[model samples]
Target: MRKMKLPESFLFEAGPRAVLLLHAYTGSANDVRLLGRELQRHNYTVYAPQFRGHASERFEDILDEGSPDKWFADVVEATRFLKEKGYEEIAVMGLSMGGIMATRALEVGDYIGGGSFNSPIHHIGKTRLPETFISLYRSFNKRMGVPDARIQDSIPRIKTKRTQQLEEIAEFSKKVAEDLNQINVPYYIASSGNDELIDPANGQILKEALMPYTEVTYHEFPELTHVITVGPNRESFETTVIAFLNKLNWKEG
Candidate 1:
């Protein structure tokens, strides 16, 4: 039997209050599907949209079509899509790069409030993401039967482009940091102490930056890796999310 291809985006509608979930760098909407289902079970509608150029087998698609600007536009569009569905009480969150996108949206988009799970907000100076993207590219091509030698031959060019793309994220993070005063709303942030891709210190960097102007709920999970949504202590993390959502007055009259 042929394997069925999973969708790039997913939605779970359960209630009037909605949450938009974002995926990680080089990952599809699937990254947040599990957490979205959990949120849905708790009666919050969940929608996870695939970033532009993501879920594509071609690495060039991501390099050429994906960037902070384009993905942030995608984030805004996803929230609009939710609003059109009649969910007026909307919140947005994301994993990693998805979290960065969520932060940008919270700055200027329509949201009651939102946060990120292991997102690189203030600390984008140097990231492991470029290498992660390149590794994924190589491994994906290898899975498609590309020769290892050929895959290696393409690594240098991919790395250069991927590094340049990462610079876009760093630039965006800098912008968010500079304009932190614009985000005068509730926001959630979580960090994995064991995270390897981004410095865990980013949680502190973000809180210190946002706390002066916003009501920030911050957590650092010592044992969890970069993806805290599906970590071992996910139950507790989910509970924290529930608590945050419950505190929000995100309802229409």
Candidate 2:
């Protein structure tokens, strides 16, 4: 079968300093499109890469291929692409699951600083049945070749996969938490106090984890949800990001 074409990623070129924006799990480049545009207006080159299995014809594809490793690969590729283009100073920002990737990128990529929004450093609620069922359903899908199953027929599977993916993400987040001290770059961490998906305490968890090694700026918005980037106070979110970037002092030669 011919692979489905993913949605267009965003790249805006203007200056030697660059910013790589990463979207949430199961989300497309569109999640961070507005932020990318804002950075571009500041004359900062920006790139938002679409993750594998995301933005495809079916959400099932995300279940089959969207692992943390694959998402991190997207981050790695975007950062290297910017470096190859001669951007001497680069920063990475991630939202939700992308936050984990951005945090991990600081350890592997040559970035000056990074930021994360509404990310869970430690997952809440302990449930294993969902992931168990998701594994079974995925196997059933592969055995039956039911890639185009209807919503009613696949809703349980979809929910299971989403839960399972979060479990996987939590595992990775725990690993990142353990090694947070190795990430010696300045970081901006924020979360909503009433985030419906992740516990608001995660923001403090991340901030505290990084405090021993690097500069950490933490913020809490009591009114916003997990998806703060596109919330009612989205302008405020954008302003916060712009301010963080402006403070980097990466002057082009």
Candidate 3:
């Protein structure tokens, strides 16, 4: 539960119709800046805030603090930030961990519409995401010049403890999935047929869960992988997002 002094959040002011982009687990706002810029080019005000413990260099920080409950609180605050800035119409979107947040945001807020990109929404128990995160933690530490030998004990301990937080995320995802029908606004869902961390089949679960009660926009990029907001095929994904936003009945203030 420590703060990182990272000045890496994105706020591109363009129009009154705003967007809140949430980054994936352990990723900074840099993960979504490409898509944010694309949205900005189309005259949307894009705000990509940094999640707690992500901006810091220590992997333990996120392991200890990046629970879904805390992230939901952050997303709520981010939405309020936009409303205070005179933007009444806001759409939320996120990648992976952020996708979960965006879906939950719709349940509680009067959002115009929002969705997720390559989010793991089905069979949370099957994904090797925690292992992926732990691997990423080691890679990041290596990037910071910390060798594996020195951090041997710490990494294992962190891995064991972080599983609890991962469980919290699973619980949150299940709740959001079950509550998808409660949302009155449109929801967008994207999937990668070849995502390394999350199963592509989860897209069907997302579509089926929300389509029965509310409007849902489901799209898939077969050649792409997770975090489409920043890498190859990102532009294509952004176009799909723009089309979704265009169809929304926004009440800009």
Candidate 4:
């Protein structure tokens, strides 16, 4: 519902191929910068936008505006913007909650040549979060000690009123996965075997759902927990990602 001004400093590479990097909840464009840099090294124009209805504004605020439908619209608009700029071949990638949004976007958006998703939230089922999760999140937030107005809410959880919407979102995502298979494009997906935030079973669901997409590559880092794929295993993950892009023949457009 609102736009976070993209930093002019985020230089999109001089390439015909474009990649949109989406970040997770409470995350900003900066969070995806490393991934963008890597993609840019391959001559890809990168556009990583801030999603709508963020926890910074208020945890509950995201509930009102960050619906899957709105996010899908946002991604389409972003893709079209890139297309107008002469970047024809496009790919979209997202992590954590953003991954969930990407699927919905891919289902309805156009001009997507391929994509990658790391730690995607394919399903937001009944809240099964443990108390430890809440504690750890709060502790980390406190320790980080950074002031982010948009994400100043209490410990995050699935907003109660949004349960119906989440269920619908899951269904929409499932359909998106099916549609992804029909498209003749290469996809790279990475998941952590020990993602405490999302059930590992969800990873299985994603793998199974995307199985029909014949040109798919999946990697699971068993030792990587939740967001650790971008942390401890950063280099390895980046290597896999570069390989995936190379395989797709998505070099600098």
Candidate 5:
């Protein structure tokens, strides 16, 4: 199996307290590269795993191999890798879809805290309609024997396979939302008021869901966009994450 020509998984050893950083859907480790470096600078071991089927130069390849289960498995495997490396006190943080997977990771890993940035706990906008249309178009194209590359070039944003993947993810997000109480660990949730992809209200929904079971800190970056981990407000995002980790009060092993 050939891997995408992109940055590999990053690991920086510094302390017993380790932090696992998960990237967003259709995104690779490079998306969280800055945050990983920042965590390492604070003397914490950091590992940012590249999600399966991501980092590919072609979007079609990603759509072909990507799935919600594969994303979840990637996080589980990353946590296990961290534990095997002697990281006892572990924390998880993710951006967007990564945030959804990070929460799921807590169910199977011994994590002290988790952070979510611009993650959607529910679907918004046209939702499945566009995907359905894309699926119909794809079927027609297939019946007509259109070349894959031509089909890809004609409709780059939506594909039947990718639409199905998104639907799977939406279902998973609903499950995570319903089981929010299972997240007993201290969690950090951040959203951008200006985010065009995920509605910022989902942050409040998560905070409300977890209020009865654990500590939840919600922050609204009014000026930022969907990609809060990178771009102009990245410094503030990293600072908030480090502050959250510092306040976790986990004993250094």
Candidate 6:
């Protein structure tokens, strides 16, 4: 039998609340599918969209399209689509880079009841070329070769070291740091003290940003790595999320 191609978007019907899941840079809908399944047990209708340049490329190609505006637009479109489908009680969640987009979505999406960011990249913060990180990136770029300029121009742009795609992850960092006082919504942010991919400082910056928000909760796992929240440490992570949701009167099915 011939295989059928699934839509770039995946929707899971469960509870009354509709929760949109945004995966990290380079991750496909599959990356957050586990989280979606978990949320379903809590009666959340999950919608995870495979954003542009994702779900069908190497990590490098996906990163090539990693502009804030692009993902932000995808989230906006996804939220609008869900709203049209009668999902009024909507919440947004993302992992790593996707978390940044989730925050931006809050600005434009209607009726965002809540949000969560796991191992979020709040700010790139003056890259100063963390020698190791830059070296790794450059090495990967060398292996990946240069991407097509036209293709790169097709997505929403962000600022970076290059003249192209200038949404500059650093700009997101600085803006959030200065204007964190403006976010007035319930948010749950989780991080690991030992997460090498995203510095602990980033999580602290997020905490400071959401401090003024009435229902903000921050949890840290000192011994886990960037992806640990999904694997071995997931139980603790899930427990915290449940408690946080319960504090807001979020119940399971």
Model 4 / residue 96 / CA error / Å? 2.5
Tens digits of per-residue lDDT for model 6 on 1-253?
A: 1233433668998767788888765456776777778777887788999887665423334447656667677888888888899777677777776776776665445444455554444553432223333344444444456454533553233223322433465566455455545556577787777766656677776777677654578888787666543676677876776566545544333
What pairs collide in candidate 4? 55-150, 55-151, 56-150, 56-151, 57-150
- Score every model by TM-score: 0.94, 0.84, 0.94, 0.74, 0.85, 0.74
Score candidate 6 by TM-score against the native: 0.74
lDDT of 3 by residue, 68-135 (tens): 88888999999999999988899999998898899899888889989988787565436778788878
Overall lDDT per candidate, in order of appearance: 0.84, 0.78, 0.84, 0.62, 0.79, 0.63
Between candidates 1 and 2, the one scoring higher on TM-score is: 1
| Tens digit per residue, CA lDDT, model 1, 162-218 | 889888888987887787788867999988888988888888888888988989999
Q: Model 3 — which ten-residue stretch has the worst lDDT? A: 1-10
Per-residue lDDT, model 3, residue 2, is 28
Instruction: Judge candidate 4 at residue 246 and give its lDDT.
Output: 61
Candidate 3 ranges beyond 4 A from true positions: 1-7
Report the C-alpha lDDT of model 4 over 139-169, residue by residue, as the tens digit. 4444455354423454344344455555666
Query: What clash count goes with each model?
Result: 0, 0, 0, 5, 0, 8
Question: Model 5, 29-52: lDDT tens per residue?
Answer: 887888888889999899998888
> Considering lDDT, where higher is better, how would the candidates rank from best to worst?
3, 1, 5, 2, 6, 4
Candidate 1 RMSD to the correct structure = 2.1
